[model samples]
Target: MKTKLSLFFIAIISYSCSVNQNKTKQSDLPIIGTWELISATTKEKDSTFSTFNPKLKMIKIINPTHFSFFQHDLTMGKGPNPTFAAGAGKYTLVNDTYTEYLEYFIHREWENNKFEFKISIQNDTLTQQGVEKVEKLGVDRIITERYKRVKN
Candidate 1:
């Protein structure tokens, strides 16, 4: 009877430890890192179009209350090498949703544009939806993009 009771208690302790370990591992969301754009679609003036050879990357630094967005795109080039478009901004997360505020710099064409959007991060996928207005072009565009985490 004594040996049986000892074995039962040992099994219960081992099960409790395994459950806690699994919960800790599951709580860690894989969103902190670099993500490459798989696709992007935009709607403007009742017309929908997609970007071709659209190579874009975004780096996100996760924080307790907010985060940062570092975005860059590979510009289509006719020459030997491709150019890049880069920008940086900050964001806030509420209820597992994020809103990014972008400030353009590296790409002169987007210097005067401001962007605001909500983002959803799930496992290795990140999705963003937002409206962007370009003062120079006098156009309002709706943007939706999906990114997959690039393995380090």
Candidate 2:
């Protein structure tokens, strides 16, 4: 009887430990969801500047190997109108880093761009810092931007 009781207690403790482990693993997953822009820093000509906007926002949907980013300028208006004026792209995340291969449409022209960077999340704040390379006027220029998560 004592042996049976010891085995039962061990089983209970093993089950509880497994449940806690699963929760920890889930929490370690990347922060992949709708996020907003809190601030940004642009590196240009050996100088960096803070570019945080109170009206700019973004959302990201991350799947296993691919993710999508949606950015919008909210200074224009509120509600659905702001979301309508947005840009989107697809990307891939390896480990804790992400690379975006974005095709943007503007002024009746489509432009291809690439962004590579590392990402981190602390509570509701998600930060992404990366370099973006784009062709402008037949020349390639590299720009860096950092984003912070806001809300759903």
Candidate 3:
């Protein structure tokens, strides 16, 4: 009788632990969704300027392990200022910090680089800001971007 009681208690404790381990916290989940860019700005040295044109549309999709972004002109790349840009790669999120690996890009020189940013989401809006610096490309600037979540 004593042996059976001890085994039963052990099994109950193990089951409880497994159940708790399967649950994920809510804060760890808000970043996984489709988002549309509302505005973007870049600051370099003494100059700050807007990088997002009102005529262009940009969307970014972030999953549990990866993220991708694409932007194009509203005129279907046929207007006076045709533009298209896209990049994608894996990412890691720790608290409010997000890091992305640029694995795919039209400009090959920008690939294989790691970019880290601080992100914050309030209601349906998200803001990301960080420094993007590439010595080979002579690029060093701070970029701030705002996005709204896409609803189904």
Candidate 4:
């Protein structure tokens, strides 16, 4: 009986450690690089997807526990003075959910908002999708962005 109880305890401890290791390993696998935004799409209420051809180019960089994303329009003063449209903050990735806490943004109202996205990676492509409700934009929709991993 003593030997059986010891074996059971060892199995339990080992299983618990493996679970934690998996979480850590999985989080360390993807999203640790600079990604350039390839495309952005929004899904309407009727289940139709509309692509937003952004005037600015967007780039995102993710570290272990922090991330920064920024966009700059290269157009030389065509509309609204093509300039900076960027934000950055800390991020947490658990399982496949990516949550970003806005620490800095051009619009003050956007700061401190917790933005969550469902993330996936394949080969050199990264995809993120999430439903966003922006009262200022007067629209609530699902946004999906595809990014290509930038070669360092």
Candidate 5:
């Protein structure tokens, strides 16, 4: 009888521990949905910043282990060439950090690129700030974006 009780308590403890670990992993980023870009800012060479035109529409979709985003100058409908830029790949979320490996991209230059960002979501909005070095024209550029969750 004592041995059975001991086994029962051990099983309960193990189950409890597994449940807590799963919760921790899930809480890393509760970011699994489509989001519309509110703004995208880039730090310029001279330490200045430039934001994309508000008229440009960008959308991001996150799934269990894959993600994709696309930008369009036209806000609606399919065009002969609507995508300004688009990419899709597998992604991993750890703690507050999100990383994506570019498996496919409209622009060939970005193919196989890796993107690391500090991700945070609050009040129906999501923010992603670049945590990796991105250079252009011999100047370091940083990307910051704010997105609003699209409710279906």
Candidate 6:
């Protein structure tokens, strides 16, 4: 009887530990899902705000350790000024601060750059804003982007 009791207790402890471990891993990821970009704005060095393209559509997919984004014109690439952009990289999120290490991009000059942004989540919306300064690329601006979570 004692041996059976011991085995049962051991099984209970093992199950409890596994459940707690799963919860901890899930809690660590607050931004694991698909998000669609709704709007964006860029503030140049002169403190002028430039609205992003209203007709363009973009989506950013984030997993446990990596993120990727794809953007293009809504005209199915048939517009007079067709556009498409995509990039993917690993990222880290510590509380409200998120940092992305750009690993792959069509624009080679923008690769291997670290971009950090402050992020916030409200309801189903996520907003991130930070400075984007790459001297070699001649890009210096503060960009703010708002995204809505894409529900599956």
Best by the lDDT measure: 3
Ranking by lDDT: 3, 6, 4, 5, 1, 2
Which residue pairs collide, candidate 2?
36-150
TM-scores, all models, native as reference: 0.58, 0.57, 0.81, 0.73, 0.72, 0.79
lDDT of 4 at 12: 100
- Model 6, range 1-152, lDDT digits (tens) per residue? 99999999999999999989776232243688899988888989667665667798889999988999999999999989999999999988877888899999989899999999999898899999998888997898989999999998
Q: What is the C-alpha lDDT of each candidate?
A: 0.64, 0.60, 0.92, 0.83, 0.80, 0.88
Question: What are the RMSD figures for all models against the true structure?
Answer: 10.3, 8.8, 4.2, 5.3, 4.6, 5.1
Model 3: colliding residue pairs? none
What does the lDDT come to for candidate 2? 0.60
Model 6: CA > 4 A from native: 1-29
The parts of candidate 3 lying over 4 Å away from their true place are: 1-29
lDDT of 1 by residue, 1-152 (tens): 99999999999999999989775222234455667677788998889988635454555554443344455554545445555555655555444445555554575676544467667777788887888787776768888888887786
Best by TM-score: 3
lDDT of 4 by residue, 81-135 (tens): 7677778899888888888898998987778777789999999999999977667
How accurate locally is residue 44 in candidate 1, as Cα lDDT from 0 to 100?
A: 88
Segments of candidate 2 deviating more than 4 angstroms: 1-28, 58-85, 107-110, 137-152
Ranking by TM-score: 3, 6, 4, 5, 1, 2
User: Clash number for model 2?
Assistant: 1
Query: In candidate 2, what are the lDDT values of residues 20-124, reduced to their tens digit?
Result: 977523324456665656567777566777765556665566655445555666655556545333344677666666677666444223346667777776766
Per-residue error at 102 for model 5, in Å? 1.3
Cand. 4 Cα-lDDT: 0.83
- Residues 61-133, candidate 3: write the lDDT tens digits: 9988899999999999789989999999998887888888999998899999989899999999999999898
Q: How many steric clashes between backbone atoms does each model show?
A: 0, 1, 0, 0, 0, 0
Segments in model 4 whose C-alpha atoms lie over 4 Å from true places: 1-28, 47-51, 76-80, 135-139
